[model samples]
Target: MIKSVLFDLDGTLLPLNQDDFAREYLTHIGAKVAQVIDPKKFVSQLLASTDVMVRNKDKTKTNQQVFLEDFLHKIGVAREILLPVIDEFYETDFVLVKSITRRAAAARQAIMAVIECGLDVVVATNPIFPASAVRQRLAWAGVDDINFKLITSYEQSHFCKPHVEYYLEIAAHLGRLPAECLMVGNDVKEDLAAARIGMTTYLVTDCLLNVKNAVINTDYQGTLQELAQTIAQIIKER
Candidate 1:
């Protein structure tokens, strides 16, 4: 039986177009840091650095390390100077980007229902951001940080989603097998990828991204309301 539910944040529980949200986030932070560096070049360098971090293979290397290393390499600046600048962006500029997201009452209800069913809850958002950023986003979704048993963050995670090892790591951390977990997200590529290790998947179609064009084959798919109803029915049946 499924005893836990893992959820993605941006496009899944939080209703926002990933591309538009990302563009707004980068633009907002870019404007703030532009006073110290060229805005356009800063955005370009930051994105390039992020790309490098996403592709990094060293499991021991934190996402922050990967991003910082690549960013510092491009700017040719001392690591000490860059830390304060990045800190300023996350602390101040990042808060403004929350306006792009929409809150769903049903999403919160769905999460509550899962908890009531005696299932463990995990905010399995991609471990690209630090815990503070993840906590901020959770607030946007009407989910309190304390609601989840564990929230994935760069400091505690070594792998990114779509990698089976990432799911395996979480499973091991929770002392549960993959088959006893339910993976829920709006992205076909990232969320559905957990199925390879035996976790059942529920695709939230409202903000779906079928990057690999794989959603057509998934049996469990629906909008947030529909998902809430499905979960309710499952609990009733149980």
Candidate 2:
């Protein structure tokens, strides 16, 4: 009864080394904003803001607001000053980092298969970055500008990955039960957390991350094409 398919962006839908991706992202953005503030300081402050967003428990404030408040405070600037820089950086500079990332055709095929089955598709990437940044990354994946049912950016999300509450929130937002959703991701801890709350899970192993060395117990696991086949099989059975 999987009515929705949630996909992770970084290593799942887009092939990339997470560490390398982060470094490239920061370097490009820092270089772009260096004229206004110290590049090193800007990077540090942005990271601190991400940490604050991760630890955020307040449901009232979106992760975006929490990040902005902390980021703007640490950098000693108004949102008016910092916001434009970030927006422009994502628009112009973020594209340069795509050189380190490669296309994931399996992911594109899988997404198309899911949509063809008449199931909802959601981009459940970790909400550490803003919508503009997320959109740009999706563009790099070759599926940019396609309308997904939802895209979890820091501006709209309240919780980060590895938290069951985040999955629950997505389920709620989609008006579906966890049992009716399938969570697809490359991270064992973060993506598989959906299973804890009753959703089915798929682990995409092409660029998998298992930092905790935790045992994986998802319903299915494999490359993105295999994942698509699994979903198709499930839908065919239904």
Candidate 3:
């Protein structure tokens, strides 16, 4: 029996255009740190550091450590000097990014459905953002009120999405075999990768994000409304 359900944030639970979200996010953060660092240089180094985090496979360092190590090195700033500013931005200015995101009622319904079935719910968004930022997005999605089994963040994760290791880490955290967890998301590549480790998958198609036009091979595919009902049906049959 499935013991847990993993939900992706960006196009899955939270309705958003990934490109637009990233652009607005960078714009807001860029303005916040403009006084000390040039926005262009800051954005460049940030992207490069994010890439470093993406390619990171060294389980010893969390994605946050890898990102900061490369980011601070290239940006030529001390952690003490820059971290507070970024933290403050997430606390204050990051809310503006919500304007680009739409609230999905089905998201909360789907999560609640999973919870009511006594299954653990995980917000398995790509672990490239600080927890504060991820939580903010969760709030914007209207699903932050409930407790989660795990919320993948750069501080806690060593790998990013589309990497099989990321799924392994989450599975290890939940102490559930991959087969006992159901991966649900909108991305053809990132979220569906969980199937490689024996997990089942449900592709949320309301905001489908198959950018590469890859063939869909998920065990299931449907909109968020259907997902909630599907979970109910799955439990009933069990």
Candidate 4:
């Protein structure tokens, strides 16, 4: 039985021009941290740190730790001086970037379907941001303020998506085997990677991110608005 659903955020639940979202996020975050470090330098170093998080292989260190270790090393800033600034930025300024995202009421309904069936739900967004930022984005998507049983964040994660290990980590965290979970997302590359670990997949194609044009096999496929119906049908059949 599929005991849990893993949902990706960026192009799945939240419709967005991913490029614009990243640009706006970096711009505002750069401005916010400028008081402690040069804005240009901060942005560059932050990206470098994020890269570290993405390539992280050390299960012993969280993505956040990997990011901070490289970030603080590159910029020579003490963690005490930088963490609060970034945390405050996520708490206050990050919400402004929500303007770049288009909302979908069906996204919430889809989540509700999973919840109604009593299946555990995990927000399997790439753990590239802080938990606070993740919660805020979930709010913007009308997901009832972090209703997911688990929200992957850099602080609690060791791997980023498109890596099978990332999906495996989530399965382990949820105490479910890969075959017992369903991964729902719009990205052909990242979201589909879950299948490599034996999880079933539902491809949300409205804002699909299949840049490589890879042929994918999805157990179910539809747009975000079609998701609730899909889940309902799945449950009925089950």
- Number of the predicted model whose lDDT against the real structure is largest: 3
Per-residue C-alpha lDDT of model 3 across residues 21-126, encoded as one tens digit per residue: 9999999999999977888899999999999999999999999999988999889777787889999999999998999999989999999999988899999999
TM-score of each: 0.92, 0.94, 0.97, 0.94
Give stretches of model 1 more than 4 Å off.
235-238
Candidate-wise lDDT, in order = 0.82, 0.87, 0.91, 0.87
Task: Write model 2 residue lDDT over 1-238, tens digit each, in one string.
Answer: 8899899999998889989998998889988887788899988988888888888888898888888888887897667877788789877788899999998777788889999988999999999887888888898888886679999998889999888888989999999999999899999988998999999888999899999899989888998878766778865653
lDDT, candidate 1, 1-238, per-residue tens:
7888888888888899888898998889788876678778888887888777767768877777887778888876566766688788888778888999998887887888898788898989988887888888888888864468889987778777778878888999889999888888988888888989998888899988987665354547899888887885654443
Q: Candidate 3: what lDDT?
A: 0.91
Better of 1 and 3 by TM-score: 3
TM-score for candidate 2:
0.94
- State in Å the error of residue 132, model 2: 1.7
Q: Which ten residues in a row have the lowest lDDT in candidate 4?
A: 229-238
Q: After superposition, how far is residue 179 of candidate 1 from its true place, in Å?
A: 0.7
Give me the displacement of residue 138 in model 3, in angstroms. Answer: 1.0
Model 2 residue runs over 4 Å out of place are 235-238
TM-score ranking from best to worst?
3, 2, 4, 1
| TM-score of candidate 3 to 2 decimals | 0.97
Error of 4 at 137 (Å): 0.3
Lowest-scoring 10 consecutive residues by lDDT in candidate 2? 229-238
Please report, as a residue range, the 10-residue window in candidate 3 with the lowest summed lDDT. Answer: 229-238
